[model samples]
Structure formats: C-alpha cells, structure tokens
Target: MSIPTGTVTFLFTDIEGSTRMWERRREAMQEALKRHDTILRLTIESHRGYVFKTVGDAFCAAFTTATDALESAVEIQRKIDKTDWGEAPIRIRMGMHTGTAEERDGDYFGRAVNRVARLQSAGHGGQVLVSSSTQELLADNLPEHIVLKDLGSRRLKDLDRPEHIYQAQIGGKEEQFPQLKTLDIRPNNLPVQVTSFIGREKEIDEIHRLLNAARLLTINCPGGIGKTRISLHATTELLDIFHDGVWFIDLVPVSGKDGMWQAVAGALSIRSETGIPLDNTVIDRLKNKELLLILDNCEQLVLEAAETAGALLAGCPDIKILATSREALSIPGETVYQIQPLSVPSAAEETQGEKSCAAGISEYESVRLFIDRALQIRQTFVVTNENAPALAQICRWLDGIPLAIELAASRVKMFSLKELYERLGDRFEALNRGLRTAPPRQQTLRALIDWSYDLLDEEERELFMKLSVFTGGWALKAAEVICGSTAPLPVTAPPAWRDFIDPDHNYTYKTEGSIATYNDIKPDLDVIGLLERLVDKSLVIANQTDGSTRFVMLETVRQYGEQKLNDSGKSRETLKRHLHYFLLFVENYMTQVEDVTQNIWDTPIREEYPNIQTALKISLTEKEYYEYGVRIISSLFTYWQYHGSEMEARVWLEQFYPFPDYIQDPLTRTWITLMFGWILSSTLD
Candidate 1:
C-alpha cells in the first residue's frame, strides 16, 4: 500500500433526524433532497470536494485543503436552509479535520478518516464542528467571515488525547433546525460487579464463541442458576473487542411491549429534538456500527424481545446481541447455551473433614462455590479431616445448586456446619431465621422458590402441590393419573362428618389429622387442564427428552404445593380422589407392558421410587387394590424381576394379599398369583 504524503482534510457529515424526516414526512425530505441535490453538488465541487459516500443520511467527503472543506460545509447548510418545505426543514451535521490520509485505489483511507467520523458524530444535529487544525486553517484565511465557538477538547474514537473542536454559528445564533437522520448515542455507566460471576468458565467460553460468530447468542438456564450474572460477565470480558461500547438493557424492569424500545432508547441516552420514533432510529444508528448488546431477563417477554432482536440482527450486521433468560429467544442465527448448576460435594468424602469435602467440591463448580462462601461466613470453616465429610454430605443434600448452597452457607453465622447438615431436610425452618436483610424474594430458600410459585394460577398451584407426592421424578402419565383422579367429581366431606361431627369439630380435628377413602370422593377440577396449567406455570418441574415429558418435584416445592392444595377449600372427598387417581394410574401402568417397562427404573422416576413405594403402601386400600392396585403390580412384575427388586414387589403385595376380592378376580388374580409365586420361588430357591 502506497502512503500519501500531502496535506489532506477529511470531512464527515451526518444527516440529523434522518429517520424522523424519512418516516414521518418521507415525501417532504425526499423532495427537499432532490431540489437541494444539484445545489449541494455544485457547492462541494466549487470548493474542490468529492462526495465519497452516504451513511443513512450522512455523507463522507474529501478535500485537499481545510479552508475549502469548511467553505463547502457552510454552503451546503445555507442551501438546505434556503430550500424549505412547509412543515419540516432540512438539517445536517458536518465535521472536518485536517490530516494526511492515504488514498486506497479510489476511496479515502487512514486514522484521520476515523477521527473525522467520530468527531462528526459528536456534534448535535444542525451544527457544523471542526477539529482545531481545520479551525486554525480557516481562522488564518477568512476568520472574520464565519463565526466559531471554541468547544473544549473531547475524546473521539482511537484517540487517547482529547481533540480541540469548534462549532460554527450561523448569523451569531445556534440553528434550531431538526436533524434528518438518526444518530448513535452511547449509553453511560453500566452496572458494577458484572465480573463477579462465580463460576461457569465453559459456559462463558461457549458464549464468547457464539457472539464472535453468531449474530445472536442466548444464555438460558433455570431461575437462580445465574444466567444474568454469566451474561454480564461475558459482556464485561468482551468490552474491549467491540468498537462501539457494550450496551446493557435490563428487561426485568420493562413492563409492556412499547416499554422495551423505550428502555433501549433510554439506555442509549437518545434525546430527539422533534420526538422521533426511537425504534427505527435505533435500528438505523446501530446498522453501520460494531456493537455488543446485552439484553438481560428476556424470558417474560421472549416473543417481543425475539422479534426486536431478529430485526436488529437483520438490520445491523456489525451488531451482536447477548440475551439471558430462563428460556431461549428462538431467533435466527441465535445460539443458545444452557447453564448447569454448581458442583455439590459427595456424601462420603465430606464425612472425614473439610479436606475431603473440599477435595470433592473442587471437582464441581457448585460445591466449590458453596465451600468458599461457607468458609467466608465462618473462619473456622476448614475442609478438615472431620468437617469435610459433613460438608460434602450437606452440599449433596442441597443438590449443589448455587442459590440453595448460598442460602445454606449464609446460616453459618447462626448455625454450625453440623447443625446445617443435620437440618438439611427442614430447609424452611433452618434457613428462615437469617438474612432478614435479603429481598423478600430471596430472604429464604423457600421464599426464593415461592416467588416462582406465587406466580402460578389456582389450578397450577394445586397441581404443583399434588405433584410433591412424587419423590424425585415421575412420568407425565403418572402425574396425569394422580391429578386427574376426581377432576370429574365435586368435593364433598365424608358422610360421617356431616352425620356424627360438628363443623367446628371437623375443622379442629381435620387440622389434627384426617383420613378418607375414594368411595366418598368428589372431584372439582379438570385434571388434564390442571396439569397443563401447572406445567405452564413452571410450578411443576418438567424434564422433556426424546419426545416425552416427565415431571418431578423438589421436596420444598412439594411442601408448598401441598399447603396450597389443602388451602384450596376442597373437601375430604377430593383428597381421597387425588389418592385414588394415583392408584388408578399405577394400575393402568401395570396393565400396559410398554408403560411399566419404559419408566420402571429410569432416571427422575427411579429417584422417586421411594415416594411411589410409600404412596402405594399407604393409599392402596383393600378397595383401591381390588379396583386398581392388582392391575399395576402385574404390569410391574417384569420390571421388578429384571431389577431383582422382587422383595419390594412382594412387600407391596402383602397389603393386597388379604384383599381376597382382588386375588379371586381372574383378571387381577392371575397377575398377582404369578408375581407372588415368582417372588416365593425366587426367595425359597
């Protein structure tokens, strides 16, 4: 590349309020440009200038002398001012700088070009600004003719030192004409501590890769899993790579569809002179610039945000967007990274001491974070030979989830690690005492989860509670059975209640303990609809894979749901119906070879076996067993035999063995006889 070694002045000019001029009164701006185009060309030519190109409504041009460039800029503004339409007048911003610029084939090139462009962008619309070099050159020649205000030195792109700038005044007053093109405004002072992202190196690396290549990258994870923190950290890491500074838009604060664009405009600090539409203007401004944008908390308004992001990506090739949410935006060229939870310590390793706990935790991110935070709270918190095992066991009990671990760790000031470990099962009772300072939503582990719970509808809340009957995980069909049992019937108290017990006694005694059977049940809800609503509300934790959706419940969530279910004002009959529904579902599964085999020992379901077993043990009354339990156990025989858990099957059958009605019925009797005989033979042999 040959370098040019002569005095050259680069001129960068922007059309102010171009979007408003084009969109609001497009015909008028087009007509004005047409009428003024000839005059504009002649003025530049007379000053020995050549128009390089136009950016939206802005234009770049070249001149050999700063004086000539300044004169051309003055005439263009003068001609536009002279040719005015009825409602809106034409306006523009012109910036000039004198520096030796290299000629690349036919186009102008060099750092001077970049400086002039940045300087032009700094000036408000309807103003002409020039660097000190150009101002001095003009002052030396025809200083008395044109008015100039010495604006102090300011920062521009790629320049360390502030450059001296002067704005030209027309007729001793600043022009009040509107800008024709939309201009870019940089948002100021982002949130502090974005780099405090505790873990997730692999996720951050994947996000960085996606942003570097894809037009859109979405970070998706469960609530309290730190998607927001990770995205912000990634943004902070990527700040240096983008020319235009990173823009952070917090979506959680925005309430409506229109508020999204307003938030974005506010973040960019856009102040339009004529109440311009910020959306179209923002798109146009970002089109030609290289920028990194972080849009946080997009799940609630995913469709709206996705539409906007898609438009931005299509319009702005140089722009990359990073969005964080509980789900994906699903836009084109979008890459999604699902963040996983932190590592939790294993039960055995933590039993020895802090050393073993720390060693186990070092293998997983979540457990490591828990240890680090817990240690901060208690200085004596060491992964010693003694505490290590207990810490590991505690982390395991908490599932190594960051939020749960954090809450668990916060109790160190008031509770010992051993106390926390022992009370892990009663999280609400244990963690509720500390952190009155935390937000109401995050005050306790239960409160944090309840926020998501409280957002559910009546049906969703009830279904979520009923789902807690399931231990760790369960099949969707099983949930449907459990929730659907008495949906078709209205709830009614047992006849014994109305006949023998008074209302006050029933309330008091019911709180003490209550029990009823399915024959007296009433169903008030549509089970299918309830399940759908619960799944929709996210009150039910669903695991969908390989074309099937499974659901499971956290113990804490289950307890919350059960409380809601009882409070839903249902009679004892509805509760019985709910229990019966689960029994009938298990029975249905026993009849189907495919159903029993498919989920008999698989994950999430396998985890819930204890709960299922307990439910079966308690709810499989003589009447329900004769009605439904016989069929389910028969279907499960194959599974039990394969897994060598014939003892569990036989033990469950012991409840039904005395219910001779089921054993006598051929349909139920045959499967029961076979399973019982098999278990007997296997044990005896």
Candidate 2:
C-alpha cells in the first residue's frame, strides 16, 4: 500500500486483550488475528484508505478524507463484532486523527501518526475514537447510524495542550468493555515528596473517617498553614483502602471548569475522544472505580472546582474527592476539615526545665518541625537551654504556620535562633529564604499573600486594603460603613463630612441612617458579596460572635494589605474615610443610648476600640484634621470613661489644646475643655 502525504486522516487499530488471547488459545488467536487483519484491510480499501503498515494484530492506515477514515473505522468495528472464531472473538479498537504528515519509503511519520496511535490506545475493544480535527472534517457528513459523541479535551502523552476527542457511535450488537486500558493502567500519579512527612497522625485518621463517611472532603486553611501537606499525607495513608488506587490532580495550572476536568483526565491518563464532553468522560471513567482523587490548590478556581466536585459525586458513586483549598467547596455532601497551624509551646512550657530543654522543645509539633527542617540545612543544630526560648519564640512569631517555619528554618545556616526571632518582626523580609525549588508564591510570606490578593477584583482588592484599618477585626456593619462606600460622599452630605471629600470630583454615598441596608450601592460590586469572596479566597476569616459574623484578617495578611495600601498611595484617603465612618458610627450609637442598654452599645465599641484608636492616631497627626480628631474623641468620651483609659483621653485632649485655631466645631471645643478640666481635677485630688 502507498503512504499518503499532506493533511491525511490516519486510522490505527489493535485487538483488546490480544496477549491474553495468544496465551489462552494460541492456535485460535492466530485465526482470529487473520480475520481481524482481513476485515480491517477490506474496510480500509473499500473506503479509499491505504494500509501503510501492519504489526502483529495491529494495522495503520491512511485516507485522504476524515469521512473515509471514520467510515473505515466504523465498518471494521461492525465486521469484527459480528464475525466469530470458534474460540476467540475478534474485537478491534480503532482511532482516527487528521493532520499533516510526511510520507517516505512507504511509511508515515509525524505528530499525526503518534496522535492516532495514542487515540487508539485510549479506547476499549470494538470502540472507535476520533480526534477533534477529524470529527470537524467529517461534520454533518457521517453516514446514517454513525454519530459522534464529544469526549472533551484531553492531554495526550507528551502534548503541551489538550486535544478534543470524539467517539464514533455505531449502533449494533458490539460488546461494551471496561474503561480504556490507557486510563486504568497507571491509576496513581501522586508526586514523590523530597522531604519527610511529619505529624498529622490524628488528622490523617480523621481524614480517613471523613472520606469513609462523605464523598467529598475539602481541607480548608489559609496559605502556608499546611493544607496540601496534610492532604498528601492523609491520602498516602489511605492508599491501600482504595482498590483502584489514589490519584492526585494539581489544579494550580488549571484556570476554569473545562481545564479542571482536563487536569483530572490527564492525572488518570484518560485521553478523551473528540466530540464527547470531557466531564461525561470523567464521570463515566470514575463511576465504577473505588478511588480517591486529591485536587490541590483549588481556591483560585473554587467555583469551578465546587461545580466539578458536585457533578462527579452525583455521577460517580464510588469516587471520593479529597480536595485541598483555602475554603470549603460548599457542595452537597462536602465535609470541610479546617487545617490549623502546628502547636507551639507556651512561654511557661518553654521555661519549665533547663536540663531537659531539648526534650521539652521537641514535644511541641511546631518546634519539632522547625528543628527537623533546620537540621536539613544546619546538621549540627539542636535545641538547648541557651536557644529553647528563642526557638519557641520563633515558632510563636510565625504563628506556627508550617510554610513560614520551613522558610525560617532555611535561614538557620546564617542567623542564630535569637537573631531569627528578632528579625521575624519584619516577616516579609525574614521569610525570603525559601528554597529555590519551592513555588514562587511560597518563596516569601509577601508573595504568598500577594498571590491571594491578586485574585480579587478591583472592588474586592480595595475593600481588602481598607479592611486593614481595623486592628483586631470588625463586624459586617462596620465594614459596610467604612469600606463599602464605592461612591464618594454626596454633595448633600453634612459639610463636615463633605470637607474630607475631594471637591474636584463628584461624590455619591449610599443612603443615610439605616446601617442594615446595602441596596443603595452599585449592583455589580455589592459589599456583602465582595466580603464573602474575600473570605472564600481565605484572605479574610469570618468568626461567629453573639449570633453575628465578624470578619478579620491574619496579622501577616493584614500587614501585607497595609503595605499594598501604602504602595497605592491611598492610605491617607482611606484613613480619612475610616475615621469619618467610625465617628458617625459612634454618634449613631450615642443617640440610641437612651433606648438601649450599656452592654448593647459598649460591647460593639469595645470590640472596635483598636480600630477607633488607629483612626485617632492618624487623625491626631493631620494638622488640618485636628478639630475632627477632637470631635471623634469627644463623641466617644463616655466610651473612654467606661471602657477606656481616662488618662489617655486627657493626653489626647492636651495634644489638641495647642491647636485650638483648628477647632471649628463649638460643641467639640467645649467638650474638650470640660474633659481637660476634669482630668486636671482628678489628677490633683
């Protein structure tokens, strides 16, 4: 047969379980192989295809048109499925792909040839798989009874991008076999860890229990808290429990819902045929396999991941998903395991025994981890009485975050434990010694936070930075008042509030007086949704307090946000808004004091004291805003008297005394004078 050149469609065929047939019925297998070769060749010739090569029971043929190639494949499957050898049935799997190829010495070679072979390998016996290119060429031209089912995009061996695959459905009595051997041959694809896995014994057991009870388990935690490590360790322990084997799919490189399933198919070595939806291919492949799929780094693509997990759980009964993300998938049957930081010894525990300092230090999981990682770089490093306190201090400073601890431990070759602890105050700089092989985001604490920050939309990013104004944390109502203002202060607002606004630009604020209402804002950038997105991205954490949710950031993340706010050169304006909002918040509470109990007003004020103090500090420094500062401090005088320091209030009043010229508000001026007089009397008496 003559080899075809240029854009030619290649069809490759091989028998399923051919080796087993040869061993069980060697004589009958030879006869069956002969019949398979005869039927394939005849079908190719009839469809204007040329058989280029034949190896054992396999045939490689080429045709000028995809229609001819697909037609030949369908006919071969039909003929083989109907024919019977006394002992062996000739079930042939065929694959067709269209691409440009070079013909030399009666042979075909190039990516097209290799692709067709991979496609053939990805099919079951009596099934015909076609590449998307071939399916497109044969679009609306398939013979009656020949239909194409899209299998979605797939990452074939050695290919950079995924290729769409399709299955040629020929209605008949053809035998339906198990999933393609190409996908099932190598079920597990977990990466080998370079370092030893540590701790999480209880976590591993609990994960096992959760997996047994729930079809989907997501390990949720902030970056650098060790979610990935814990999931990997837990999966490794449960390897034997899964009969089909455990597979790991890294979704960091995947961007959307389509790419997510492609990653899963690639990990399972399932090369989807063109024309069939990839999700369908995944569900079909996993429906019967009792296996565990570990999806890592799903936070950025959480919505897509959640949808895919939900679909898989609903479609595949025996497939369980163990996903590692910054937050829960929120799908039905999903059990979220929030991974916490490793435990660090308390100061008392660190100082308990001088002679047994090393033993005591090793007892805490965080310190033990630090020492182990430190030994990797500095072999002679060991815990002793001289450095136990510093070691404990280092772990505590890093908040027992595993990634931070590992990065810090990497610096032991240069800095002493004490020096490391001292430098941790500027953790973004101290944690820069990450291993070169680590991912870019894990290279520095700032980079880790930057990654999560970059994923936010404009409004979300703005809200995140503005949220840094709160030191401890703030309630949803406070966030709405402070950071939810997308529009500027309206012209109709009080002149005192409008004075802080940029008069050069138009300003519009949400309707006044009702703190619970969020309807008077931009529909696209709702404050509630932005806050929830921040929480979902693990940038902000939500805590339950007195039946309400309070959102806060980790100290490290807040510092990063503050740095971003400073870099944006908007810290001054944001602080102004923060101070203005808090002043109004206090005023509103004061007016309601007659109807509400002290606890009602004091509880929230006490919770926001740190934020109020931060705003006051910034306000006090701005000479032009000194009057506003005095007004805010005076408005909260009762709060200061009941819940804060009377002496501190007096000091603030004295700071503003020298700037009386800036005091435009008469009531604020009089209140400041009265507070100053009372502080003087109390100090003297």
Candidate 3:
C-alpha cells in the first residue's frame, strides 16, 4: 500500500539492547535480525500500515488510523516476545502518535514524526507507548488483549510541550519498567518533581523559544508566580541543544559578588587555579563548554547576578543562561520574559452547572493546578456541583497566582473547600502554608513578600508601608501627597549615636567587651526616587493607562504592608493622613462634578472609589478623624442616594452615630519617627 499521509498514526520501534546484542553475538545477531525485520515488516503491513523508513534495526511505520497503528504495535511486541531466537533474542520498544503528516521525497516528516521517535526513546524493551492524541482515538477500542495504563506527562527532548503518555500492557507479562527516560536521557541537575506539573504548556514553549533566541534569558515574575518551575520545565525539554550537561545555580544564598561567582563555580564544579580569581576560573572553565545554566532567585541579588552573567558571557562564548527573578537585569543582550498569573475561569463559567463547571475548570490553567495539588493533600477531594463554585471563586480570590493557589490547596487537609473559600477574604494568613524543603522566603506568604520587603532601602520600605493606605491602585501625585514624609534637619550637627562610643573619634571605649550601642540618623527620603526603586524591585507594579501611570501592590503584598504599618505604631497617623488626603480630593472633585462641562463624577470616582471608600471607613471609625469621614460621606451623600446603593449611607451612618473622640498627637508622630533603639541591628552588633 501507498504511504499513509495526512492525519496518520506514526510508529517508531527500536531494540532496547541492540548495541550489546551486536557486540556480544555477532554471528547469531545476523539470524536474529532476519526475524526482527520479518516480524516488524509483516505485522505492520498486516494491520493495514505502511513501512515508510528504516534506520539500523529501528523500524518506522505509518497507518491511516490509531487503532491500526496500535494493533500493529501490540502484535509486533507479542510476536517478538514469543519468538525463540535462543542466544540472540531481541526486545523491541515501540511508540506511536496520531497527527497530520507532511510527506516529501517518498518519506513522511513533521513534528508528529519527531514526537513519535522521542516517545519511543522514553520506553523500555518489550514495551509500547502511545501519546494522548493517539490514546484519545483509541478510547474504547483495544488492540487484541492489550490494556492501557497512564504514565502521566513526560518531557520529551526537542518537543516544546510535554507529552502525556499511556503504556500498553499485555497480560501474563511481568510488567515492570524503570522510570521513563525522558529528561534523564540528558545529564542535568534539574529537580525531580514530586507532583505532576499541571499546566503552562504555552508558557513553556515561549520560554524555550526565548532561550533559543537569546544567550541570556531572564524570566521576570512577581513572588510566587512559578517562574522557576516554568524555567525548569522549559529547560528540561531543550537539553538536547546543550552538549555538556545543564546546571542549575540557586542564587538565594548568594548575596555578594564573591558568592555569585562561587555559586556558579559550585554549580559547574569548576576547579580553580591557585593564583586565578574565582570569577576568572569560572569563566575559563566554561569558556569552551556548551551548556545551559539556570540561575534561580536572581531578584535577591539582582546586581551580582547581572554582573556574573555579564562577565561569564563576555568570556564564555558557548554558554547560555536562564535566570528567574522578580525583576529584570537591564543588561545588554538580555531578553526578559515577564510571567503572568495562570488563567482562571470567568464568573460566567462558574454560573453553569457541574458538568459545565468541570469543563470550564479543565479549560483553565489555575483550576487544574489547584485540583492537581489538592489531590496530593487529600486523595478523596473531588469537586462536586455544589462546591465547584466555591473552588472557582477560591482561584479567583487568589488572582490565579500559582503559589497562592498551591498554598490554599494545601489547606485541604484541614478545611473543606467551602470553608477554605470563606478564609480567602483574608488570604495572607489563610494561605500561609509552608513546605519545609522550600527556601525560608518561600515557606510562607508573608515570608515571600518579606524577602522583597527586606531588600528595599529604609525609605523605600517606609514609603511602601505608607502607600498601602490606598486600595485598588494609586497615582504618583496621590502617593506624593499622602505618603511622602521628609526628615527634619537638625539646627546643630549632632554626631549619630554610633560616633559617641567610637574609640578612634570619641576615645570612649570604656573597657574591653563593654558593648557600645549606637543609633542612626535616617537620611531624608524623596517619594519619586523611592517609587522607581520599588517598581524596579517588583514590590510594586506600575502600569501606564491613558498616558498616566498607576502603581499597585498585589493584594497579599498590600496586606503585608498594612500589617507592617500596624506593627510600627504608625497606622493611626497614616490612616488620619489617608483620611485627610481623600477628604480634599473629593472636595475638589465635587467642584468638577458641579461643572456642566463634565457629565458625571463616575469617570474620576470609578477607579479611585475604593481608595475613597477606605479613607471614609477610617475617618468614620476613628475617634480622631470623625469629622473628616463626615465630610467625605456628606459630599457623596447625594450620589449614593441617587444611585441607590444597596446599603444606604443612612445604615452606615447609624454605625458611627456616637460622636467620636479626638486626640491630637503631633508630638507622638515626630517622636516615633526618629532614631530609636527599635532598629537593633547597628554599630556594635
């Protein structure tokens, strides 16, 4: 028969121990080859298949349908298993996939063809494997007595997407196979995943393309976006491109330049010369090695990572780097790919019935990930129609973030899905699950944000906490107006406490081990400069809308900042300032609303409404800011009445009916903002 072309099933077969067979039994192998060729050629043709190509002892065949291809594979395996070749017995491994093919020069070729070959390479002797694409076609149809068993998703070399494989098991055959040799086919230090990777096939392909195009590819994502997992998955699929093995260098512990190069050296196990610098030694060792190096957690040491990557590329021509960071290193010749949160099903999808809900979740990445991870924690966990809505809402509440989803999923052991859904209203505390094997920063939701928070300078951290006063997002001008606080300069230059106990300057070292203490005079801060650094570090997200920029912190991030503000004893002052800022903002906007030239206040109020509402809440509730809240509510009283808010201002007004108290404490504000012993890490430590 002529070769099967479009929409055909391709089969690839190889001998498991062909090389050893040829070396050990040269005389008997010639006879064994006759039987091998006869079995493959005859069995494949009998199943209405076409033999397109043959390389060495490996046979490549095609069939019009997956059933025909699978039948051919099963029959061939059984025949080989039963054959009595005595001393030169051969074991054949087969792989198959169904896809459209492109035939040229009397031979079929395409991605499907390449995929089948890799599928076969991942199997063992006397085994047959089928891709999900093929397995779907053979859903109920079986090949004789063959039974199919799922092998899960496996990364195949040269394939951008990982393949979901099903193994064909025959009865009466002791069916034990070693780990399917996919990523392990190459030498790499990638971590062994404990759970099946859930989604991000498109992202993995994009990352692979970016790596192929750029020598240095930095994956920039916020904390807990699964950038490292995606990078590792993508890197595993492209191991064939690297000659020397791929290496993973974790930069979490590498804070300085020396630690950076040494981390690289440690990853590559490069030996250093006595007189040569470690950086030079690392560069020299990798100068001629063709490898892929994954630098994980570069955000903690962004500068050092940039410098190390730059120096290595400047010296090593054949080395490539893949880095994951919360921020990008703006170095030349670097390609940055920002990873977004996984997809979540829309609210509309959740409204449908259970059948539709399951379909909806399967179509989205975030829900699938949550389900996959939840299974590990509680095997009996299954999403039912009654609870499916809650599950979908949980993903939405977490904003489709993978880390947050995983953390929430881990709580399946303790709480039901509905109970877990209720807790998401305060996700920072609810989803603070920790994995002991993870880095300290990755142990909890707060710790992850704290990593970025600690990296900020004092002013940046201060501004970050102050900016949390607003909700949704804030404008630059708004942040400056509400959050900016400049330090007061002293009339006389008083040496900081560190100077008082210094032996060289003060000669005040009273005795040995006396333990000198010192306090610092914090430098003046500018809002504009600190905001830039905060955005660069990924603690704050900046977006340009209608030629104007808006800055935002993630929900959990904003919560952490709020917690920090509360702990610092600055919440009252900050809330009063927030109250005062929005009070004036509304009073000015009311003038615009009164203008017949402008239609409605909706345009200005729609985006900033949340912030104003937050400010109003603080004003109404706080004893000191009662009048500020009264003014804000009074200004919007007519609008709220006209729009007919479900809960009228009257109801909310009743909650704060009692006259609030006021304690004016400008002295306490100034007193707490100074050099106190609260900051304990200084001078004599």
The most accurate candidate by TM-score is 3
Which is the winner by TM-score between candidate 1 and candidate 3?
Answer: 3
- Clashes counted in candidate 3 amount to 0
Off by over 4 Å in 1: 1-190, 194-196, 330-333, 345-358, 433-440, 454-466, 484-547, 553-559, 569-582, 585-611, 617-685
Better of 1 and 3 by lDDT: 3
Predictions in order: lDDT: 0.63, 0.75, 0.75
TM-score of each: 0.55, 0.61, 0.67
Ranking the candidates on TM-score from highest down gives: 3, 2, 1
lDDT of 3 by residue, 542-578 (tens): 8898898999987777888999999989887777767
Candidate 2 regions exceeding 4 Å error are: 1-187, 196-202, 256-258, 272-282, 344-364, 380-397, 486-524, 587-602, 635-661, 665-685
State the number of backbone clashes in model 2.
Answer: 12
Q: Candidate 3: deviation at residue 668, Å?
A: 30
Provide backbone clash counts, one per model. Answer: 29, 12, 0
Query: What lDDT tens digits, residue by residue, belong to model 1 across residues 353-398?
Result: 5437344455567666765566556645555545656667776666
TM-score of 1: 0.55
